[model samples]
Target: MLLVVAGAGAAGSVTFAAQAEPADPLAVYAARIVGDRARTRIVLEFDRKPEIAVRYIARPDRIVVDLPSTVFTFPEADLEARGLFRDIRYGSMDADSARLVLTADRPARLVASEVMANESGTGYRLVLDAEMVSQQDFEKLVNDQSWMTASVDATATAQRGDRVGQSEPAAPGAFVIAIDAGHGGIDAGATGAATKTQEKEITLAFAKALFDRLKGEPGIEAFLVREGDEFLSLSERVTIARQRGANLLISFHADTLRQSNIRGATVYTISDKASDRMAADLAERENLSDAVGGVSDTGEPAEVSDILLDLTRRETQAFSISMADSVVRSFEGQVALINNPHRYAGFRVLQAHDVPSILLELGFLSNKEDEKLLLDPAWRVKIADLLAAAIRRYRLPVVANGG
Candidate 1:
């Protein structure tokens, strides 16, 4: 990457010249973090009718953002004081959209999201809401036992001792993980035009790998929506996560787009408008995965009761972002970043009854460099190992709590 000036008269800064020919007007992906009633929040931004998407995912804590080829103009001093973000990054993830990943000191929230054309209408503006959480309350939420109730039941069933060992017929431990491998039997997600690797297979393999690593944790366990190759409706997937009383959910997948050179790993949380063009496009594709297999979003989620549940929603959202930070921190050096690495999109699998969730696109089948990593068992295992370690570290405090 080289640096150059920006204007004829305006003092040119050290901005790099266009790295490559601009493909189609790429998406302008943007997001922010906020504090909820009790949780951390994340808000995303983008311009015009850019494709965008969002979702809430569990496990390894994080939010993912994807955008078309676009340049970020934030300055060093401004970023340093951005309290909502624990840390931030940007780089050429692929030909399209530079990815962004923001790590948080604690769980936060995503709120006050809106997208519209500027009054002048020459271009667009994306706004985000990032809130801060007090340390004491953040700790309280982390160690809370209400969510840990499942562990107590599992231990009682074992009776003999802890649920770690001894086949108690009672399955596994306290926390349940909802693993979603995007696409299914008949649904071949994005395909690599050069390598012909289907996204369905790549995602399923990654999900299973992550699941396998979570098996031995003390208060944690996991479950998959589809153990084998079969098309399960999106609602059914949600049902399965709730059925197991999961505390977290993680969805896995790889997608291909017309932007062949775009690629990198992305973590996604949930949002209605989506952050940018790429995020919106990806969310659309993922939400439509079931359609390829003859299923549809029934638009029926269980009724929300117990206003207490509302109290925890914000807390849960914060926890999700905190978790995402851990994963992003671990990804440093191990992999490259897309301009706005972490993004938001409307992902269905993340819509659980109460489970905190995260969806990770390990890489893109669309980019040649990324495609190579996605197909590499070594790379896959490395990422999975990092994820498992991060989750383990992320949960230690919770485990310490009386819960």
Candidate 2:
């Protein structure tokens, strides 16, 4: 309903064809998501010519089409009809065409979408049917937009010593473990009463340690979605995991509160309904990370209906809870435990549907013992080993149940 169509152009005529050679050769345009379930569609137009050949392929989690130098933008009206997608993202893949990414609110099954000739000339239309995902899943999709950054920084790229550039072979079937360091940059999380160490710093150190251990393990790989002490939106956290094709996502956090007795670790997965009142409150506070940090949530009202959103929420929650249990058990003896170690909260960062994700509170900064342990290198290594094993163990059930 909120399409940004200018309504320009005559009513009847449409021009269709890709130009062969003009003053400069025109490149055809293509769009598709680029991960697990690769679904692709393309459109080409020219004033007086036709395109030669373009290559497209469908991967397990994404769809990609390779074309000549071309840029793509959404035609306003068609975008409005989509109640499913939260955003459409793209960047230049190379000097050739661009890579288009779509984030959907609910999991979707792409029946068919294409750009072809109409009665008058040429046009583009894409169609998709929604596959219901739980509210947890939908929220993860919504949250992902914030986690991803378009960094093409050379030094950072070089720092990624083993990372593949655009031309490298896709890391197919590589087990993806999503690492989330609970708070970042300005978000100090919990503070040590005695040592005065920040929770953000401890979590980042621990996350990086775990990432290194995962990388060394066979058949397993890991990456921290956030590399620095930068403020990242919770949704962006989930986006990082999904983009990396993570099968399991683990978010790290260490916090403090007035309740001095509270200590030890806890594992949390997303839930449509919070598991307990305390869990609900914790989730509410975390969800407001963006707003609390001074980002405005007040904006133009969404035209999407409430009923449809609720329907999607009903679909994927149980899987989220299962992930929490997987992690709590994984760290059983190696880490300290909190009351009812496995918990459920409405965390935006733990929302990806296809991937099972959980948030783990490494320990409470309120406790002196916990704070010291958090700063220890030995604890980081032990915790990382426990975490990696849990990820590999969790995969068995997910594959049998979902795939």
Candidate 3:
């Protein structure tokens, strides 16, 4: 006895409704969209009442919905782009948060959003109605209301405070190192020209090797940002590292470049500006992981106006440079390194203000020789050992001084 609109303008279609408890405590079982350019309706059926928070973003007009820990069980095709919505995406923001982003072809605002028990009385429905709005109005909305959630800038400020009051490490302090394997799930990164080896796979393999090598070392604790083929936003990566209390974060990547002849391992640290055109171009593409995964940019402000946070970032950047230098020195005779191996760029993944971070390019997949070396297990092991040595050398003084 449920009226189901199978698709846009499908008025006669009727489907029986079935409700079952989802294994997860909270979940979205179904989703649909209807209507046209000027206005639209979005409906989602949830297993239970969900606490939802909404935010409006401009530049490219979009609406973001934040939810508590919840599983999305609906078919991807269910939320087809129609009406005012140009694109729709739903995914995990982190371990505890999920997000739904709706991008519009033009400025649009949700005029109505409500949750109510369904006719079956076994589930709940979240209904949203959006309509086109003037660009001026949208801009007004964007400026008038402040997003209350902890944005990247706010989180970094909090982290700055955390570092200020940090206590000395225990005897033989176990330094936590976060190994982030770049590009996974929907974002398949760059491809190897010869072997067609996915960059995600290569990065993951090297991350595991590095983690395995570091986990057994004394005074070191290592954790992977991702365990499998899963997508994580750039901001989410930073959040995870900070949550893990990581002292250092090393993100591994194997990228392909336009110049096929250019290839070697390179180390990158975050900077306000790129050191060179190549670094800038690479950072630009790497920052688009979220867009590639169908998620709109959060459009949250990145710059922190707080003086304490700025100071923390500067100090962290220095430590990152020191770590990068250590890596370059370790790879000098042991592994092939790019000219001026250490580079700098505005990499979003390295934006954790209190945690020193570096992104290591294992090799360029564009070069046949580099790709071959990247695929070799023995070569990966050798690189992992060298990286371990670098980390150990870098930590010696810090550990002795009670980091």
Candidate 4:
């Protein structure tokens, strides 16, 4: 087994023992992680030089290395999470390809990544150096997707806006609504107190019910931001809405709070300053979804100063507020709502400059009563129906005016 320990100063050493050649064309026998929080280095010793492709992905900054089929025989602890990296994984992607994914703690870039032969020429070494960078620089790296990788997965392609079921253009005059189901995959949002059901499952079920309820309506097109139990960054959620040309974006979440007694639906719109302490605290927690899912929090979206864009945002915010009010009104007797249900906060998922967006807290999972209701299929159907009614009411005026 290869054992690695950091030495004094900025260097580290990996002790390896020679082993018999493996039948596989390529094999990685050793790997190590070196450096600190500001920078990180990863070295992998291979039996021979292997063709590699590197790509940078954003919406939670990650570096991906695509390689030919190979056997990874190193100990799992050799490349444990440390420094700038929050998590690391290497495994077979398919029968012919292998992948190494590195998720950063913050916006980062691979400053150096290359393969070179060892001094004795018996093997090759794959070295990668990652360093923290400004969000702008990292975004630039993500945008430059000129990697020569042989193929791009469906998810990656869809993330760039060519979704499978949504590639076809919406019928003209259709009022599109993008329903975002918050917290999935590695980030499970909140867990139910009684049933222990995950928030992701709840949101997805509600989102689907709402979508099914709305899809049959005339001149309306509803789609899910994340159709499955997969994680998406706050920005990606907003981007999906924008790319789909959605007139309204509604994000569904069920979160726990310090006050377990507080359990009810709340509609939130974006604001530079939160409407109250509760709003601020909730926004802070929800914004950390990326970090919780091993993706770096790149802070809020950049402030736009253009006069036209500013005006557009003001109009959009007004629409968002109106939608929130409609939601609260629709749930008045049909569903429970927290005090001051129409609140405003600087939620990243609601920061799409032109899209009218709102984050809807279905109900706190911390409260046993609310947890039971959140998990009840009948309750979900009732709530979804009410939400669909609210959407129709909010868009009625626009639809009437031939908008």
Per-residue lDDT over 4-69 for candidate 2, one digit per residue giving the tens place of the 0 to 100 score: 000000011112122122244243232232232233222333222332221111111222222233
lDDT of 2 at 199: 62
Measured by TM-score, how close is model 4 to the native structure?
0.65
TM-score, per-candidate, Cα-based? 0.55, 0.54, 0.63, 0.65
What are the lDDT figures for the candidates, one per model? 0.53, 0.50, 0.72, 0.71
Off by over 4 Å in 2: 1-170, 298-316, 400-402
Worst 10 residues of 4 by lDDT: 1-10
Best by TM-score: 4
How do the residues 55-170 of candidate 1 rate in per-residue lDDT, one tens digit apiece?
A: 22122122223344555544434334245555444333323333344444455434544556766675565544545455554445434532443353232223322212322232
Show where candidate 1 strays beyond 4 Å: 1-173, 216-219, 300-302, 401-403
Error of 4 at 265 (Å): 0.9
Sorted by TM-score, highest first, which candidate order results?
4, 3, 1, 2
Global fold similarity of model 1 (TM-score): 0.55
Q: Which ten residues in a row have the lowest lDDT in candidate 2?
A: 1-10
Candidate 4 on 1-403: residue-level lDDT in tens? 0000000000011122222232565899999999998899999999989988787767567887867767789997999999998878665433355568788889888888989998889999999999999999888777666343214543333433446345567789888877777876546667667666667777777777788888778888887777765557677777667777777766678888778788778878889999999989988888877655433345667776899998878877877777778888888987777888888888877776777777777778788777777767677678878877887788887567543
Candidate with better TM-score, 1 vs 2: 1
The lowest-lDDT stretch of 10 consecutive residues in candidate 1 is: 1-10
